[model samples]
Target: MNLLRSQLGRPSRRWAAIGIASAAVAGLVVSLSGCSSSTTPKAPENTVAQGQWPSYYPSDYGTIVDGAKKEGGELTIYSNTDQENWAPIFRDFQKKYPFVTKISANNLDSDEVFQRQLSESATGNAPADLLATNAVQAWATYNNEPGRVMEYQSPELAKMPDFAQVMPNVYAISMDPVGLAYNAKLLGGEPTSIADLAALVSADPAKFKNKITTRDVSGSFGFTVSKGFVDGNTDAWASLEKILPSARPETSSGTQIEKITSGEYLAGFFISSAVAFPAQDKAQGIFKFVFPKDGTVVLGRGIGITPKAPHANTAKLFIDFLLSEEGQNAVSEGGLTAYRDSVKPAPGRHTYGEIVDQAGESAVIRVPYKITSDADVKAFTDKWNGMLGK
Candidate 1:
């Protein structure tokens, strides 16, 4: 079957949809401050309160906004967050802080964001105000790299449960659990486990061959999913080995779901709800998604300020907004499962924290395991690549 020719839907245009909505806001900042983003600070020593962030009122938030406005309201971000997912968030932020005139969000997937941070380091140009990404690449790139990420203990930190903070510098903005999606019209039987997926495929390998979809473990979000699978369950890899032969590798959940919608593929494993939720609504009832009982994959997507961000105050404001109840509301509307449990549950899907509650703690495997075992990550990646016919 010619996958390309038979395609009926294209991937979501999020990557190309960066919102250039800050020009006016930027002008306002310039008019107000007569200062450039260069006025923003460089290191922690130059920073204000390190941990006393998002203060209740006049003391903290007011100061932050005033500082941000003076810094030119221009904040650039490097993240995998899609335009459709983040546009509302950024817009809402701009509405709240009209002085923020320049908000540019570049749509880079996790791997690309990680690599770019490195490139910036080499050239000594860390322009991004913030870094938003999954734990896999985020931790790999910033956690160990001593001075790369900034530590802002936003008062939002005090509200979040200790576990929600991925690391000292990184805070979980939202989470997208790996959902099992199958063509609704094509597969009627609800699968409760990965073994069920394998059995279904084993039953009809011909139809399933090259028709199944999963993260490409060689890179992208797949790298984290692969590692999380091994760390979570011993039997997970065995089930994947059963399905990999017929599965087509896709680095993106967006493309995988497009294939699933188009009938080029029938199912997608470990797909992000951020992508799946949008596709489900856009595909007109063609897709059905559920978390598996054996163990569902959960990716905690987080953010942190940069060490030498050009718009440090603006970046902090953005981070504060992201962790705020209002900002998280925008997060849910964007499609991904939200991180904050306090954020009221949406109509159809609840916050991922609640989802985890309903699924039972034992049934969920949070990806980017807290324990970063390099040897284990290496072993799992190697095994996954080998299974994928590398």
Candidate 2:
């Protein structure tokens, strides 16, 4: 469960080996090391009723795994997950399809992952078989460039809410809810809304000056989250701009968290609560978080099938595995908000449903990414940069 925390709005991933140990109980010893590609009994027909099943219940699990084994090509993955946090998911995947030999996983930000796929296409190559990213941002970054990402409708699509399923291929596997991360001792009191945050910083720019962390609105993650904030609240833009004068722009969430933990910074906006809270617990600091009452952007860590995947069948199987029930268990244990309501993400972490239940549906806004134009990106970039004299 160890994770090398990194910031969003930039390319990232670190290697962290996950050791799935076997149980000591005589009757139940589970091994996570090796899996066989050989055919097994056909899995049950899967049908997930909305709000009914805890995870994606595939009716034909064995069939998919066996078919993938037959393809027998390494399944290359470019994702937002670091190795340690992703090891459990890969470990479980390997256990189910040992015959595949290898699952090549490399972590990258949504922009970089898209660029790699785009570059591979230009060179008449397909090195990556799958992509796990922030779907909203990926949509903007890729813009559905031909041959970059393939559209394969997963049956699990029907199981998820319409909002979560942005494209046939780019669908959310996990939810990264944006929230406030503040040094409890520094922030006179927690700000509940964007307006509250604006007032807090504007009142005494001197105290928060250079101590408030934010992201430049140009990058993929920042752009997507900013769009959501602006769309969700009328005062959001001004609220964001007001903080710029006293703000310290950071590229990574980890850096923002580190600064706050060290008392160098008082607070940061849009720190992925799911990512920050866990690291906070481990660091044993006074760092705490809150879901913005006015609105909170929930970034979807989505997955897509590569257009020219060397192992197409294997990619499909891996996709199904990720959406499967056990996969959800891996996600929860690995540390992140579970995408589905039925999922019980690691006990302490919150579920998408739980967040929605407490914040109200209106408060959980998906990052607005449908607007993908050069002018739009430039406008956002210019506005942010102008504020900082960048």
Candidate 3:
């Protein structure tokens, strides 16, 4: 299937003529004689003129299309992921909606995505049109604040799983799994689980000492991933006790992937597939990752439109597009796991369905999107820090 033409079909000659005439009437262009003189009128900014929308999409979705066009086609996003990761998604969105003239996306830490939004909003400045991050606790807090998130139920919701709708307005943009990463050349054997890594470290404490890396559990991203894995597996803490002494904690998945690839760290566990999978493609043959045989923790990167969105209509269009099948494919191409069952498979790309198939449904533990009380966080952090000898 041609990705470009799939969502937006060819415009009929009749509609094309109508579009041109409308533009002429609006003074956007003037035609003389049988010859055309001005730049071609922008494609009609409605569902009928652009192409067929999904059958399941609401019939009134065209209103959103028209509203977005009037908003000057500008969108701002606050997310924890790098811009490079959003390149393919942004490109495809622009192709589908050519009138979207500008998009500003900022890559920030998970907690900072909301922090910045709150700060900006408090100062009477417009905040992001959309917010996306894997910080579960941060999301819970942000959602609790009145008027922070726009309550929108997208037309794409019908096709998504129940879990995809994390909260009233928030939805999962990607279902990313956390796994073990290693330097294939430096590690003697492929470690498939925490137990396997524990055995390796126990056997050769000196060699593996300070060569293992994992996330620092103090940060939101780190804490959520670490806690998710530990809570899901009964023996996780037991295995980490044998392994953590030999491990160093890092603050970000990018750092963990780099260290593993450089052989600075022989192995890293609970590393995000979203960041690791793309790098593994360029690691030659030294870097590899495995979804633990014991269990794999899947975390959803949640997204929602802000209540004070400067371009609210444009934001709505973007949220719907991201949840659509075409958007899911673009997301996978951009190095994030696409969960839609309809998305086709590609090398190095994975879907939530594929992960469940490979890992077994029982072994694929998903972290629920909910608030973590301060007490619970402290208790978990204390235990995790204690194991690390911090």
Can you tell me which runs of candidate 1 are displaced by over 4 Å?
Answer: 1-61, 121-124, 202-207, 347-350, 369-378, 385-390
Model 1, 206-295: lDDT tens per residue?
Answer: 778787887766564576665676668778867888888887778667678778878888887887766565456556678877777667
Residue runs of model 3 more than 4 Å from their true location after superposition: 1-51
2 or 3, greater by lDDT: 3
Residue by residue across 51-162, what tens digits does model 2's lDDT show?
Answer: 1223454565556556666775467887766554465566566555555556667767555666677787789976788887674645545654555567666666566567
TM-score of each: 0.78, 0.79, 0.83
Q: Which residue window of length 10 is worst by lDDT in model 3?
A: 1-10
Which one is best on TM-score?
3
| Candidate 3 lDDT tens digits, 294-383 | 889998889999987989988988888888887887677666788877886666456887777766778788898777777888898778
Global lDDT scores for all candidate models: 0.65, 0.64, 0.74
**For model 2, what is the alpha-carbon lDDT of residue 277?**
60
Error of 3 at 377 (Å): 1.9
Task: Report model 2's TM-score to 2 decimal places.
Answer: 0.79
- The worst-scoring run of ten residues by lDDT in candidate 1 lies at 1-10
lDDT value, residue 165 of candidate 1: 75
State the RMSD for candidate 2. 8.3
Error of 1 at 301 (Å): 1.7
Q: Is candidate 1 or candidate 2 better by lDDT?
A: 1
TM-score of 1: 0.78
Give the CA lDDT, 0 to 100, for residue 286 in model 3.
91
Report the Cα RMSD per candidate: 9.9, 8.3, 12.2
